[model samples]
Target: MKKRLRDLGEDALIARLLRGFPGGENLRVGPGDDCAVVDPGRGLLRLLKTDAIVEGVHFLPDTPAAKVGWKAVARVLSDFAAMGGVPEHLLVTVAVDPAKPVAWMDGLYRGIRKCLATHGGVLAGGETSRLPSGAMISVAGEGRVERKHLILRSGGKPGDLVVVTGRLGGSIRGKHLTFTPRLNEAAWLVRNLRPSAMMDLSDGLAKDLPRLAEASGCGFEFGEVPATRGCTRAQALGDGEDYELLFTVSPRRWIAAAGQWPKDFPQLSIIGRLCPPGQGASLAGGWDHFSP
Candidate 1:
C-alpha cells in the first residue's frame, strides 16, 4: 500500500517532503521552526513565515470573514513573536468561490488592516484567485530580529524552566478569534528574562512541547497545566488553537522572570521544566492535519 499524508502525519510528512532541500550559509534557521531565520547581510536577522486558514478546517462557513482575515495574518505574526522578532511586511493570497461578495472581501481587508495596526506590519500586496469550492487565505510575512535576541526552539537546556503566557485551551469557546499574539511579552522576555527557547502554542501543549523538547535534545516534566476558566486540564493539553507563548528560561533566572512579569498581562504560569531525554513522561494528541 502506498503511504499517504495521513499515514505519516503532518510533521513526518513535512520532514519527508523537505528531506533534500538545500540550505545556504545565510539560512540561520530553516524548516522545523516557528519561522525561518535568514542572515540578510545586515546587522539584524530576517524572519520569514507563512500561514493559512481554510474555510472548513479553520472556520465555519458562517464564521465572520473579518475574523478569518485577522486570524490569517495574526497566525504569521504569532510565529514572528516566537522568534522574538517584529513583523514588517505581508503578502496575502486569497482564494474563494467566485460568488463570494465584495462586501465579504472588504470585511476581510478591514480585519487584516486592523491586525497589522494592532500588531505591526503592512499589507504590501497580495493575489486573489477563484476557487470552485471553499475559501482559503494565506499570508506570507517578513520580520526582523536583532542578532543577539533571536530565539529558537532548539536552545533549551535540560534544566531550563518552562513558562507559558496566558491561560491555555478553551479557544473553541471564541477565544481563538480574538486571542492576542504575545509579541510585546516576547520582546520583554528577550530583553530581561532571555528565554533559551521559545515557540507559540498553536497545536496545544501536548503536541508542541514535545517538539521543543526533541529539538533541544531534552525531555520535559510537567508542573501544572493551566487551562482557561471552565476548561479541563486535558483540554488545556490537547485542545489546539491556543496562540500563547511557551518558552524556557534558565532555572537561575526563572525566579526574577516570574517576579517581574508585567502587570498588564496577568496570566504567566510555570508549567514545566526540561529534563534529560528519556527521563520524562509521555505526551500525545493535538490537532493533526492528516490524522484520521
Candidate 2:
C-alpha cells in the first residue's frame, strides 16, 4: 500500500516534499520557518509568506466573508510578525463557487483592504478561480526587516525561558475570527527584548512549541500555559489559531524583559523552558492537517 499523508502528518509531508530543493546564495532561510527569508542586499532581509483559509476548515458558511478575508491577510501578517518584518505588499487569490454572491466578494475585499490599511500593506494584485464547492482565500505577501532585527525559529538555545504573548485557547468561541495579529507586540519584543527565537502560535502551543524547539535543535520543558477566561489549560495547549507570539529569551534576561513588558499590550506569560533535546519531556497531540 502507498504511504498516506495522514500517516506522515503535515510537518513530515512538508519536509518530504521540500527535500533537496536547491538553495541560492540569496535565500537566507527557506521552507521550515514561518517565512522564507531572502537577502535582498543592502541592510534589509525580505520576508515572503503565504497563507490560506477555507470555508469549511477556517470559517463556517454563515461567518462573515469580511472576517474570512481579514483572517486570510492577518494570518500572513502573523507570520511576518514572527520574522520581525513589516509587510509592504500583498497579492490575494480567491477561489469560490461561481454561484456565490457578488456581495460576498465585495465584503471580502473590504475586509482585505481594512486589514492592509490597519497593519500597513498594499494589495498589489491577485487571481480568482472557480472552485466546485466552498470558498478559499489565499494571500501571499512580502515584507522587510533589518538584519539586526531578523528572528528565526532555529535561534533558540537551551536554558532559554519560553514566553507567550496574550492568552491562549477559546479561539473557537469567536476569537479566531477577530483576534489581532501580534505585530505591535512583536515589534516591541524585537526592540526591547530581542527573544532568542520566536514564532506565531497558529497551530496551538502543543503543536507549535515542539516545532520551534525542533527547529532550534532543543527540547522543551513547560509548566503553565495561560488559558482564556473560560478555557482550561488543556484547551489552551490544544486549541489552535491563538495568533499570539511564542518566543524564548535567556533565563537571566527574562526578568528584565518581563519587567519591561508594555502595559498596552496583552499579557505575557512564562510557560516553559528550552532544554537540551534528550533532557526534556515530550508533548503529544494538537492540530494536524491530515491527522484524525
lDDT of 1 by residue, 1-292 (tens): 9977788898888988898899999998999999999998889999999999999998888888888888888889999999999999999999999898888899898889899999989889999999998899999989999999999999999989888988888898887887788899899989999999999999999999999999999999996888899999989999989999999999788876667768897477888899999998789998899998
Off by over 4 Å in 1: none
lDDT of 2: 0.91
Q: Write the per-residue lDDT of candidate 2 for residues 145-220, one digit (tens) a residue.
A: 9899999999999999999988999899888987788899889889989999999999999999999999999999
After TM-score superposition, the amount by which residue 233's alpha carbon in candidate 2 deviates from its true location, in angstroms, is: 1.6
> What is the number of backbone collisions in each predicted candidate, taken in the order shown?
0, 0
Candidate 2 accuracy as TM-score = 0.98
Instruction: Give me the displacement of residue 111 in model 2, in angstroms.
Output: 0.8
The Cα local distance difference test for each model comes to: 0.91, 0.91
Question: TM-score of the candidate numbered 1?
Answer: 0.98
